[model samples]
Target chain A: MMKSWDPRIEEMPKEDLQRMQYRLLKSLVYRLYSFSPFYHDRMREQNVHPDDIRELTDVKKLPFMFKRDLRDNYPDKIFTSTKDELVRYHVSSGTTGKPTVVGYTQNDLNTWTTSLARALTSVGLGRGDVIQVSYGYGLFTGGLGMHYGAERIGATVLPTSVGNTERQIELMQDLGATAIACTPSYLLHIGEVAEKMGVDIKKDTELRTGILGAEPWTDRMRTRIEDWLGIKAYDIYGTSELSGPMFTECVEQKGFHVWSDIALVEIIDPKTGESLESGQKGELTITILQKEALPMIRYRIGDITTMDDEVCACGRTHPRIQRIQGRVDDMLIIRGINVFPSQIEYALMAIPEVGQHFQIVVERKGALDDMLVRVELTKESFSDKINDIIQVRQKVEHRLRNSLNVNVTVELVEPGSLPRFEGKSKRVVDKRSL
Target chain B: MDTQKFVIRQISIFSENRPGRLAAIAHALGEENINILAFSIAEANGFGVVRALVDYPEKAHDKLFSLGYNVAFTDVIAVRMKDQPGGLYEVAKVLGDAGVNIEYSYAYSGKEGAVLILRVDQVDEAIKKIKNSGATLLERSVFH
Candidate 1:
């Protein structure tokens, strides 16, 4: 039978949930307008006021908050709450710009933990379940966020925050860990390390559920992990800005259930800032209604996905968002065609000869964009014959061309030479910018 | 008529076409005291397959594999042909007439004679046809 951490709020009627969301959204707007100078000025510039927000959909009038806003504010300049009320701080190390800081009050932490508690419970995890968190612990929110959520659901937290894979596998077996929360790439690395250590995770370990997120992964990858590791790998969604990893797909594995009372999610045309109807693909915009230290109203998350309001089979009335397609910032234009690294990963996963590690190098030659995919040859698929290796490369190139609608140069590297990550894996190296 | 005795194991290593790669592979093999009797490098699309008839095929494979090289063993037959003209045609004609397809062939001239290493689609058929054609086929002992 399906279990819920807070069924009163989780299984609430659709109309009641909407009513609650509207009230929370209205109160959050009024509070932000009264206290936050940043939001106050942004609302004035956008010609929006708290009184104008009569219905929830009127949130479209609020100016969209962006990563740059956080970067511009730097170290809590935009935080509405004072330093005394803030109990925790999580900073995302930006690759290019100044790191964005997110402060949370004690109440904010509870809301975040409660959100994950319901999420973890929806995925059928509860007491007697040992969750080994493999995400990076310090600064990064994945480890602590999952740690609190797993603990709140009455599950024993393993606290194995990334690296030491062989040791982690040993502890996983010794402690009899039942679930693990980590990035998908890190989990793949763990599986590889376990195989090298001669430990068969499927037969030897008690790990049955994987709450994998923090990097965009594909459905095909989910199938591969499930079939290979004998675990139901569920996609968890959130960023450091959203109080770490928040929601996850339940046992049904269709989409991630976004608890409506905590946050409001909208799909918007990223180019025009116009909201798209449900089921239409667009950028994911979210408004955190209950946050105190950092309340995000219409924060543009820069991820592309569609929304579904249909009730989940798991009996949750909250709306569900499909698996993240790709980040808008991660999208690359090759020869004037938009390409996502996740799309390349999805295409490569279908081929048997290609291993899990691959790097996409995009360079500008003369006038045209040249894309080269350096893929590792799996140990199982290595061939001694030159013709066989040639055929494999040709097959990979053909498959990529067919799927991406662009010609790609494929270079086969030795297995285990590609970089493996304990955190988010940087797969794309666009030399065009250089 | 015993063609099984003529089959020799050749170690093949996958290598990228980069500077010092061949040297690294040779150094690893030499550290294990393995001798490369006859070898051929096949190039395709920025990569090469270094196929060599080593004295200890299994040992060389294990050594290279331990050094993180992708190595495998293939069964190839060595046919002793005339060092002069038409020696390759003599063995080639026999295999072609017998419907044995030669996937690849590399020859080396030594004190013994010009021995043509043949990787055929039909290994047993090619061995039997070459043996029946009155040509001298080198046994595994000759290479080992």
Candidate 2:
């Protein structure tokens, strides 16, 4: 691992990275002018021509294009290259009316694979390993990105898609997978299934490592997963547009290793438009530099992250990022307090008897948002004394007040009552009557 | 630091599996206005033993016996511990090699030091061994 593809590129001393970034920005200004109608019209209105932009410092001159603009443009208006050059296409397909379609050029695909490969390797998965890609296959980047990375690493790949928990167990046991990849929440579901079928996940399965991502989780969830699954769970950081997981958890598991070799991540204050210093939390904006075909420059992704220039315990010199707290879109601003549903979910995870199946109900009450968390009791919990269950509920509600600093009502429902997702789990139900 | 102050009492409590066990323990001492300097619990296969070293050693002994639940006042020291991993290791390793077994122990966070409630096989001998090992023993001043 001495001096990755370009040590100076990965380590490109902040000042040097700035110099190279400006050089790349100049090219972005030219490309945006040529291909994107959205950017071409904006640059003209701002009187900011490609020629006026000299270096990376001139990034401020480029007007930001948001996810909305991409959605409004739909299939091809936001695309820079021709449909023929677009080797791959993925859509957001979120519950929000319109799904943003993003296309990738052939070279863009290569950069994505390299980034995904780096993430897989960060978790110690390489040649002679068996990786079961359990993330869904089409219209989503998680499955394919993991598929190709396992392929690139020359490891055996098992495309298990999403559910069929019983079959997943059958394959995991029969195939003897060394590493499993999927959402952390779904992994817990599988853990429950194994317990029901009387399979000791620790002894029955040869699973030594797992790469769980595509959803945000807490450190408490990490401990629960490790103890339950009997494997070290590494968080894989990715998005459909930014070419899949750019960061992967190293052995230290403190923070994620940013694939800075190909991508440049900058944490900037949304209001001031200034780069927040290392270790401060803010909105994250990314620039896809050096992708021969589809190059993105200073694109704001709206992800909130804890960024620091501190060197990690893993010995990599690249800047590391804390696991994403929540998307700016996912945040619920209740009476001016920023509350991510993941934070609520994390509070629920701390109640071990409560397990992972839970939902957050956000409602407007007297000009303020009132929170209610409804969690399902595990079979193991039901078999225990009834009085302990009520105490757990009280503890969960009390902890939510301390952890979230907001009042919450915790309700314990019977098992199998809450909805489980075959796709993405919709845990947050916002019922604000504005 | 030994005979001049403090009393170690083994307080037995019958706690039904319910909320406010810790709160009840806090309230029981609150009624008598006696302060607990250090405490620990060792749960049997069924019941739990709550041992406490309280301030107003004589009053705490009278208060627990009056409440009634097989409470015994014994000779136990309030040993000091560092809030670190090897901190426990050093004490445990020394007593282990000395053939002195720590039967059960309890702990609570303190402002200056983490207070330990240890029930060892040899109380008087373990106290001397712990003091010689350079560990500080807390006094009634903590409860007061």
Candidate 3:
């Protein structure tokens, strides 16, 4: 039988869900127009009033919010709720610019936790299951978000925040953790540490499910993790701006189900700033209809993915967004071709001789763009014959050229030479910018 | 005579071509008191394969590998040549005429005689051709 934390909302009819979204969006617009000066001035500048947002599609009338808006507001200038109403604050570490602070009222926290509860339940995790939260805690939403959701689902929570992999593996064994939530890279790191410790995760540990997100990963990586560690890896999607890791893929693992009651998602053509129909790939824009402290209306999240309105096989009625292809800013234009690091990873993972670590270096030589992919050769693939190594490099170059539609120079580096990060790994080095 | 006894193990290390990389490798081998008999560096794009004949090939490989170097053992034939002009020509002509392709070759002259280490495409065929051509070949025990 199917299990859901909130069956009423998760299984609501399509028409009813849209109607509820429209109602919540209307009140949210009206509240912001009346109370928040930032939203009011932006709306007035765009000549959009609360009355303009009558139908659900009328959301197009409002101006799109941006990460810049949050940065410009800095600490909490854009928040609609008052300081006394906020129960907690989670600030995103703005690596590019000023950090954006998110304030959460008690109800806002409940809504965030409830969204995760439904998501966790949809993935078939509850009670008796031990979920190890491996995402970093504190200001980052990944840890606390999964932590609260796992706890709410009646599961035993093991708050093992990132790092100390050996110990995390020890706890995973000693505590008999059944599931873990963390970045895919971190999970891979744990697997390596476990193997080095002579602890076979598949045979010894009870871990079976992984909620991996917070960075872009490929389906090939999913297969590798599943086959290697003997775990079902599910992709979780959310940003700190949207209440921090809210929705995740159910056991079917098709895509992440974005709950309609909490937030409304839209795929928009990033260049023209126009909404696209379902199943068309574009930038992910969202409207947090029920967020009180910081309500985001048509916020451009900048992630590129397609949305599927068709209900999932899991029997949930919420729409599912496909796995994030790549971020808008992360997309690289090499020799007039759109290339993504994830695509390179996908292609590299397919080749048996290629290792997991690779770095892309892009530079402008004269008038042309030159891309060089530095791939680490796995120990298993290393050969004594120089001709064999040359063949591997040529094969890698050929595969990358076919996948990316751009000529690439492949350099076979020694294993463990490339940089490895505990969190998100920065694989691209664009020397052209410098 | 069994030519297999003449096949010697050559250690090849993959390294990025940069300053002090060779010195670092040499220092590590020196720390272990391993003598490099004959070595050749092959260069490609920004990387090099350091192929060497050492007295203690197994020990050198382990030390270098334990130090995180990508090391592999390749079977190469070390042929004894006359320590005079055309000494290489005699061996090169014999292999070329026998339809054996030498991938790479390095030579070192000691007080005894000049020895040519040939990395050939076909190890067994090269050993048989060299031995059949009346060319004296050094046994693996000579290097050890």
Higher-scoring candidate on TM-score, 2 or 3: 3
Off by over 4 Å in 3: A331-434, B1-144
Alpha carbon lDDT at B56, candidate 2: 66
Interface RMSD of candidate 3?
1.6
Mark the 10 consecutive residues where model 3 chain B has the least summed lDDT: B40-49
The most accurate candidate by DockQ is 1
- Tens-place lDDT per residue, model 1, A1-434, is 33988899999999999999999999999999999999999999999999999987898989999877887789889998999999999977432224679999999999999999999998899999999998778777888999999999889999999778899999999999999998776787788889989999999999999998876678888898899999999999988899999999988999999999999999999999999999999999999989999999999988899999998888889999999886667766564234667678878888988786789998866434689999887766777788789889999999888767568999988767678878777999888631
Q: Give the per-residue Cα lDDT of candidate 3 at A318.
A: 95
How are the candidates ranked when ordered by DockQ, highest leading? 1, 3, 2
DockQ, prediction 1: 0.37
C-alpha positional error of residue A413 in candidate 1 after TM-score superposition, expressed in Å: 19
Q: In angstroms, what RMSD does candidate 2 have relative to the true structure?
A: 20.9
Q: For each candidate in the order shown, give its overall lDDT on alpha carbons.
A: 0.87, 0.69, 0.87
Clashing residue pair totals per candidate (backbone < 3 A): 0, 3, 0
Tens digits of lDDT, candidate 3, A1-434: 23988888888999999999999999999999999999999999999989988899999999999877897788899988889999999876442324579999999999999999998888889999999999878877888999999999899999999878899999999999999998776787788788889999999999999998886678988999999999999999888899999989999999999999999999999999988999999999999989999999999988899999998887889999999886777666564234668778878888989787899999866434689999887667777667778888999999988777568999988777889978777899988631
Work out candidate 3's RMSD over C-alphas. 16.4
Candidate 2 structure quality by residue, lDDT tens digits, B8-37:
554433333345555766676789888766
Q: Please identify which of the two predictions, 1 or 3, would achieve the higher DockQ against the true structure.
A: 1
- The C-alpha local distance difference test score for the whole of candidate 1 amounts to 0.87
Name the docking class for model 2: incorrect
TM-score of each prediction: 0.60, 0.56, 0.61
